[model samples]
Target chain A: MNDMARLQKQRLALYGWMLVAPALALMSLFAFYPAIATLWHSLFTRGTTRRPSVFAGIENYNDLFADPTFWIVVWNNLIYAGITIPVSIIFALAMALWANAHIPARSFVRSAYFTPTILPMIAAANLWLFFYTPDLGVIDQITGFFGASPTNWLGQPETALASVIMVTIWKEAGFFMIFYLAALQTIPPDLREAARIEGAGRWTYTRRVLLPLLMPTTIFVFVNAMINSVKLIDHLFILTKGGPNNASKLILYWIWEMAFAYFDSPHAAAMTILVLLTLGLVAVIQFRLVEKRTHYR
Target chain B: MNTALASRPAKRALPDFDKVLDALGAWVLAIVWISPLLFATWAALQPSGTALGLDFSNPLTFENFTYVWNAVPWAGYFANTVVLVTLILAGQLVLCTLAGFAFARFEFRGRDTIFILVLLQLFILPEVLIVENYAIVSKLGLFDTALGIGLPYMASAFGIFLLRQAFKSVPVELEEAARIEGCSWMGVLWKVYVPAAKPVYLAYALVSIATHWNNFLWPLIVTNSPDTRPLTVGLSLFGAPETGVDISVISAATIMTVAPLLIAFLIFQRQFIQAFLRAGIR
Candidate 1:
């Protein structure tokens, strides 16, 4: 190329770097650096005022593996994810279909479904807490009319996790509905008409055409919900605090407790690394699904 | 004509039953979903005696709201939340716009690699690295400040990704046309690209504001003082079981905490839903 062209090219590259520099710097400080630092810090023993920090390779991870609390937290989180993800997704699809249909009070129904998404999880927990309170609570009041005794929903091991799960499903289903509603809107109306012409009933049209077409959106929402299961433990603070023998403890909540409450940084760091690895696997799967989705389009 | 009328009645009967059933199911679920907020609102407005009662004869009162409002430092929490959300949104717009523009228009070495690295931020969210981030904030002497809570999220990967897609869709001819009129690269961006990406910016702003406003854990960790604690953290503290507050009072506080966003959502219901739809679809 000519000298002028080469100089312009160089200038463009310089401008590009300049534009990207601030974000890169910030990400390094918070995301990239902290991530590496977490792994590094996880390799050392927790230092107090007397003892200097020393290397203890894999000891933190071993300690976490040995802890029964950690194992319980892992199981709890798995159940949390397993239930909340699928149940909420199904509810979202049903909500989207209903709201998109020619139903009475369509907008009100949609609003009712989506309102929970806008409320902070803390507030949602508070609302549910009112409902779960022993005798004076709404659930108990209704059950009382039917002659059933008041139950301690959030106070027992058998019921605490389920109560937490109920709150999560209520909070999330509406949020996911928006994505399905968007996807549903994009689908051409003629497809439904064509299905009808082909002697397909409403159920067949939904199953054979609608659901298949919504696969990409389902995958997207699924991955998002999976990520949320790890991050969304705010309600636990108000509703259960992972109590009643830690029946409702989630992984992220445990990490916070270990690091902040107990002041055990190394163990928290180890758990953080484990969480990161799981998220990395999720990211890989998400990219693959997205690529396949693009190809389908 | 008689045969046509007969077929029409039969055709309408089956679908009518189905439609009625579908609508019934939808309304039932909607009522179940919305009952919590409705119940909360009821408890907030009713006297403590009738807060959880099924009695319809009890009169509604604002005493709970008045009591809770006086007891809590709600004004300070609101101020802190407004400041934090605004700071995060402003920083995110500028940083994400710049990075997105470069990724969209520039031809630099390792550009593709850098884009991938940025995408990785989606997975390595700041919430996951709270331990290290807390130490970093303390080291920087930003502990207990709103800036510390907002800084990590300013360079948001989601915002950048959305803006990049939006910018990439702008026709290259528009940029070339601006350039022919003696526009510099930055001038071209200002005059041509940013304006074209207005909708994406709006969508991102709405999502970011709602997300940060409802954020609890990080703010709960970083801020020890009421001066910096956002609404979510403040609400949690006020409603904690040990606080010895009545259930009605706590419900009042809960409603007060979510009222702003909830009211905004109700007012701009279409825009709020559309914003999430637009932002999530990508």
Candidate 2:
């Protein structure tokens, strides 16, 4: 009887392991393993003569720290995130409120707003490329209505980064609005009615009621938006290629150029570590911010 | 009395100006959002010479699309993308459902820890480790295959996390009764847990399909040949520096590449909205 009980327990253990083994193995190989490998690769260098990788004791990282383009890319990433997240979130919040309000054709309006979110960024960027053309774009045509000369929207360094930022906002705001809309629906109407009974004006009610209800959703949207701004801005490859003297150069685009374009895999790997650390710091800060808010909510 | 009055605001109590402004605001926003699609449609239907001229009155024609269709092997691109997305979805559904069931129903030790680890993986997406992943693909000799493109994303942390939450909401008594009736574990899972979680599955499917279909970076990195390239990468070939293709043909190709997904989305607009809502909440 003792032997049979032990066998049964062992069998269950084996079954559990069997069920989870495939998932764990894949996650480790694909996600966790690469993360650790990138960290390791950052510390080494390919020897100058043979291109054989040798332990360089963080010299690659030192080179990365000293590079001017690296700093420019860093600043560009910061500016990109700073501009994109807040503007997109605010716009999304307003859109969500407007859609959630008792407006006519709300469904049609919501679908139209949400359409851009699903379109492939590459395809949308192509569409925007046409829109940004100096002579052919609609924007140029509209500007011509006021007797202004055609301006090179994407070709000029001054407007290149902002142009990319604008497209990013257009692509993301509607999607973020969906989150705000969901959160808005969960805020019971009774609470708003109670505020109304107390003579709270629309501004007062929004400041005192809706905004507080939306704090958690706002944090989620913010962090997700930040992640996107950092990780998924690949449309630069087609639209600008970080061109016009690297004015639109972003960190991921830089990494792509280093790896494939310049054939500097080791340097690319090192820069990835910097990118990873930046993302990690931001994620940690976001986690801390959200954790504090959870106690009060 | 005040509560009643507030709950049912009198029709004449508020100024009608507020509602009128709201309507105007929504209409203006919708038109702005739809203008890009409108513009793209305009560009894609016109001839190459007149396309860049923005001659809206030149009248619509099917010539640009047919030109693009013959210029590229779009049929191959569409087939590859469909196969890739379907395989990824089918894999995710089975894997996520099983893992979610295990975490939600089983009393096994270390389950909570493992589930938290899975959630953590969501933040550490594979994109961050692209260099090492590329090496892994090359070493496995799966480079340039749809299977390679789909393999890394097959087991999604988000899907598992979501489906587990869904499964936990299933009543325990339902499972117990099935057990008492001599039903096997798998049978109970299929009979009770799955049926109860249909909506969650549909929501997950929609999100997964949209994501995989629109994925550009990974596919761009993996696929080096035209035979295996998806639409986004195929569109790039037309825009290559060497091609010198006209903008009208490029727009035509872009429309052809994205139209299937767009049309499907238009038809199932409500489902897409609801799925996004459900995903956001989860």
Candidate 3:
């Protein structure tokens, strides 16, 4: 009986491995291998027909550090993250509160807020492009009524990044609102009643009783928004192409330009490594926060 | 419980001034949020010259849509998008389910470490690794192909993690009952676990479909020609200012590309929102 049990356990282990093997293989092919290859490739020099590629250590990193465009892209991404994260979170919270309230046409309101989230970023950008056209755009048309001069929203360096940021906020707020809405539903309604009986106003209840309970959801949305600040540059492809002197150029776009457009794979790899490091730091922070949150539960 | 029950009537009876203001504010924001798509729809329906005009009485026409349809290979792009999304969802379902079951029930060595490694893929997303992934795709001779675009995303860490959570929540007794009935592990998984996790599967499927349908950047990089180009890349190429297609035409194409998902979302708004909510909570 003991021998049979051992054999059965061994067979089950084999089955388990077999079950997981396909995913492991694909992940290794795509995720693990590419990640290590990115790190490895970052340390080398870009090869050309005339000269073969060779080990270059941190030369590529140093080059990127010296490039002014690199710094500009980094600054733009930072500002992008800074503005989009908090603003979208705030909008999401407000929308969630209002949507969850005893409002008129509640489902309609929820769907309206969420419709943008369902639209592709590229599609959203295409629609917004018409609004940002120099003189005949929707914003210009509106401002024209008040006699404001036509402003090139996506053309000028000063307003270009801000214009991009506006689109990001518009696209993201609704998506984050869904999370806030979900979190709001999970909060027991009695908390509000208890707070009200204690003479808490709506603002007081929201600030004291609501926001604290929504902390975990807030963190989750914040992390997603942060990742999106890097990943959601599809709009840039449409609205600005990181043009008008690359004012709106994000890190990921710049990386794509370097690797594909400029054929400078090493530098793109180096920048990718930097992005990976930043994301890894974020993952660690998120893990720690989630751990603490679970303990609270 | 008595206080809560007693307060309900009082809460509804009071016509709070703030409540009225709150509803107004909510409606205003909702309009502002949805205005872009509304504007796009308005523009797309207008003739070429009247696209940007605010004249609501302007006669709408299907000319722009027809022009865009004939102008671009939208049919091919739509087919590519449908196939790509379907292929991705199918691959993700199978791979994630099997892997999730293993992690949920199997006692294997190195399981925790391997699970962590899989979880790490969540952060190291394909977009971030585009440079190396592109190189890998070329090395595997999948460049400019739909398979190349789909393969990298097939083994999704998010899907695997979600399914693991779902499967873990399945009652152990159900599995034991199946085992006592002489069901094999595969049989048990299909007959018991999969059925029990149907809601989870539905939620994950909705999320995955929306995600892959809207995915752009990697597809933009991997696909170089119209043959494999998804709607997003196709739309971008068609709408590039250099193409100089009229704004109405571009809007028509934009609406066309997003219409399927947008319509589905409208009809199934509750399911879409719930799916996102379910995906987000974890």
Query: What is the C-alpha lDDT profile of model 3 across B1-282, one tens digit per residue?
Result: 233443355554453677789899999999988888888888999989788877899888999999988988889999999999999999999999999999999987888999999989999978999998898899999998888999998888998899999999999999999999999999999999999999999999999999989999999999988899999999998888666778888889999999999999989888889898888777
Give lDDT: candidate 2, residue B11. Answer: 46
* DockQ per candidate, 2 decimals: 0.62, 0.53, 0.68
User: Lowest summed-lDDT stretch of 10 residues in model 2 chain A?
Assistant: A12-21
- Residues A115-165 of candidate 1: C-alpha lDDT, one tens digit per residue: 999999999999998789899898998898899999999999999999999
lDDT of 2 at A210: 95
Q: Which clashing pairs does model 2 show?
A: none
What C-alpha lDDT values do all the predictions have?
A: 0.92, 0.83, 0.90
| Superposed model 3: Cα runs more than 4 Å off | B1-15
Q: What DockQ number belongs to candidate 1?
A: 0.62
Model 1: residues with Cα > 4 Å off, grouped in runs: A295-297, B1-12
Query: What are the TM values for chain B, all candidates?
Result: 0.94, 0.92, 0.94
Better of 2 and 3 by DockQ: 3
lDDT of 2: 0.83
| Candidate numbers sorted by DockQ from highest down | 3, 1, 2
Ranking by TM-score: 3, 1, 2
TM-score of 3: 0.97
